[model samples]
Target chain A: MADALLETRALTAGYGEMQVLRDISLAVQPAEIVAIVGSNGAGKTTLLRAISRLIPCGGEVTFDGKSVSHATADEVFGSGLVQVPEGRQLFDRMSVEENLRMGAYRRGDRRAIDDDLDRMYTLFPRLSDRRRQLAGSMSGGEQQMCAMARALMARPRLMMVDEMSLGLAPVIVDQLLETMTAIRKEGVTVLLVEQDVHAALSVADRGYVMETGEIVREGSARELESDPEVQRAYLGEV
Target chain B: MELLAQVLVGGVLLGGLYALMALGLALVWGVLNIVNLSHGALIMLGAYATYYLFTGTGLDPFAALPITAIVLFVIGWLIQRGILNLVIRGPMFNTLLITFGIEVILTYLAQLLFSADFRAINPPYAGNNFRVLGITIPLMQVLAFAIAIGLTVAMWLFLLHTRVGRGIRAASQNLVAARLYGVNPRSIYALTFGIGSALAGVAGGLYGTVSQINPYIGGPLTAKSFAIAIIGGLENPLGVIVGGLVLGIVESLTALYAGSTYRDVASFGVLILVLILRPTGLLGRTT
Candidate 1:
């Protein structure tokens, strides 16, 4: 198995001519939860977008020992590198269950899909009862859970989540985080982008702090959490 | 009361054929996001194809359906890959314009070839009818309705169950996510357009059996198809049936009570009301 489930070497991507992600390099090892922390507009979402091939990018992105730099978003998805996009971009018109089914659009195995759906319901019991409800009608927290569960339905080897804690109550965020940790335990490598430094670092094994489209600092989560500079700058502490 | 019931039954039967006529246009619009102004023209062509097959080759129109579908599929595929794909990435208006252009070209060509003469496919069984509950139903109309509903169901199943169907749905929902599903956007797009065209062709073939068709019919049929798609909502295939039935009944009742000239006005008025009051459509969720 490749040491890094996903790696970006000198990755640069942007919308049109304005580069939002400069020459950047990062790696996510198998079975590790890596967190990227940055302020708003720090290119955290842009990085995920580039990695998932949603935007035109120039750089080497390799997944499972294969170069993904030239791969289309569908090709990247087919290779098992799935992303739960920001703002929970579920098909609002579809039922929650239908949205979940759409996540597994690439899979041909109906039996496995049923099994995974059952597992998703077990992980988010609230979703089970509301499966028939329109995804747009669900509460913000429930929508987030549905988004995460939908991504899981794809059976991805590496799952990228952008801003899981955004617009959620603290208790719901905690529950989501716990569910994410459980997902990682199932051997899926997770690369999380978050503005919540403390919450992210608590679950992450390693952390990278980004600023102005570049990684400004990297350390073990524990080290970064304790670093006075990081605490003062990113964690909102003196 | 009996007269009203009989009229309603007739309207429903006619509605079934209307649903079939609109099905292909609806599929193309809903899945491919192409309004396909040429849709009715393509249906006209399908009817012509069936007409020639029956008259020239002595083949049953039903038996020749596969051939018509395949030929139309190829034509649709070429149009998508050649003309449609060029503007597929551009504005929605571009598609509308190009398709309208195609419709004009096809209508002119059809007129030149078919001589602007109205044609209908009348088989040996054309006059047969079956009566139920004192309401008489034409066999052809019943068959057309059955086939229309059947095709709609099949389309729904294909989208839900088949790989290509899922790919088309994926492309419609999120192009980026669709790529992740390993579907080449260009080919999938062409394939979707082709399928839509094939459906249009099938609807056209069935239409020839029940009604007179000419190149001029394309305009009104196109308008009706658009109304059906809009009223039904583009999100689900079954929406077309509901939209078709509503339109069919309204048109029938208007023709009977308000004078035949008011039918078009009523259909257009209902369309306007739906647009102003519920743009997402009757079945679609309001955004």
Candidate 2:
């Protein structure tokens, strides 16, 4: 726990006067896939936003053993905590290759950056075919792949993916889940936030169940997947 | 027929300068989403900076352009970082009011410092004109046109190819996503505003070589720039050229046919027509 790659203590955030998250604490160890699953409006997205420093939050967020609670969003990202925000926010007018280049914006190693570009192309072969194509023109599934690939180009130590499976076909979601597992194997820790509890727990090493801005349960992925209450409420089983 | 051709030639040259004038405005509006009312004042400052450099040090007005641009860029950077960034995320009207206030303050400062007299950068060749194919062309207009086009192309290439340019583009499109790539919005916004101001300054310097400059010039010039940006649309980098040419030709034709006093009427009329017919601009995507 002391070596957790990302840790938040009593994290709370909200829009002006409308609190969305409350006293939520979580941790992701190095190279592990930690999933936070809940239904709609369970503050899953808010938690990710708070961790990324996109929105103001109360409580402590420590990444790589540094207190990033007061760090700006760019500073957080610069220190290798990156996020593929909800809704695949690709630069709509830029080419797919340009979008990938933006990922390594802070890096100055020209040759290494180029090598990473090639790796991204190989990782997401579909992106290679449409390198010159505008990012906004891609299908939802392809855009999702591009988003993940874009984040990977940053060479992040911790990648927080928000709603990766949102609005995608089941098969595409499965493919993306496999990609997340492959990413973890590359030694990058993941904090996956999802609304689809079943899909999230299937690939997570450990899981936390959120309900209305609070962690209702915490256990190993297998236990959460089989929890009677979790199954009845989230898995749509009796 | 000969007179008409002469007017067309003059219009084309004038249009090129107009394109450069609107380029800065378009960049700020398109990227920072700040419809900078102070743009013309920035342009006016550039003209004065060039004027001072010429009168004070005997530097050629054209040669003083880079100096003027740098001065304007720093002023712009400070203005954004020190003032505009605070209210940037607030209501659009707040920025509008603040920029308008800046324009007023700059105009009064220029008047107080430089006097209300009209100043012209009369380089030795200011009155030199040459006739080609029965069409007369001023030497200064040609030089201004060439420089304007060159800068416009340079800006387009910078936005398309450079790393900082890419950051500006990405930041403009999505601030949150840009942050994920280590883009600091506060600094990026200030940088963008600085670039926009520098372009405006360059355009002002060019304008001084070809015409008279006074403290009151900012208002009409800002209006013209708005017309050009709106007519051209903010979608493409080069669209300003088309918009400028349209306005220049329309103004030239109006001046010849309906007298010089009607030129403003003609330009604004075209602006209204463009707004009604195609609000996105000539090259703007319909979607």
Q: Which candidate is the best by DockQ?
A: 2
Off by over 4 Å in 1: B1-6, B132-135, B160-170, B173-188, B257-262
Per-residue accuracy of model 2 over B62-86 as CA lDDT, tens digit each: 9999999999999999999999989
Residue pairs with colliding backbones in model 1 are: A74-B179, A74-B180
How many steric overlaps does candidate 2 have?
A: 0
Question: How many pairs of residues in model 1 come into backbone collision?
Answer: 2
Tens-digit lDDT string for candidate 1 (B101-127): 999999999999998988988888899
lDDT of 2 by residue, A1-238 (tens): 8998999999999999999999988888999999999899999998989988889999999999999999999999999999999999999989999999999999999999999999988888989999999999999999999999989999999999999999999999998899899999999888899988888899999999999999999999999999999999999998
Highest lDDT among the candidates is held by which one?
A: 2
* Location of the lowest summed lDDT over 10 successive residues in candidate 1 chain A: A90-99
Error of model 1, residue B258, in angstroms: 5.3
- Per-candidate TM-scores read 0.92, 0.98
For residues A1-238, could you state the per-residue lDDT of candidate 1 as single tens digits? 2578899999999988889998899888999999999999999999999998888899899999999899888889889998988888776766788778877877879999999999999999999999989888899999999988888999999999999899999999999989889999999989999999999999999999999999999989999999998999988888
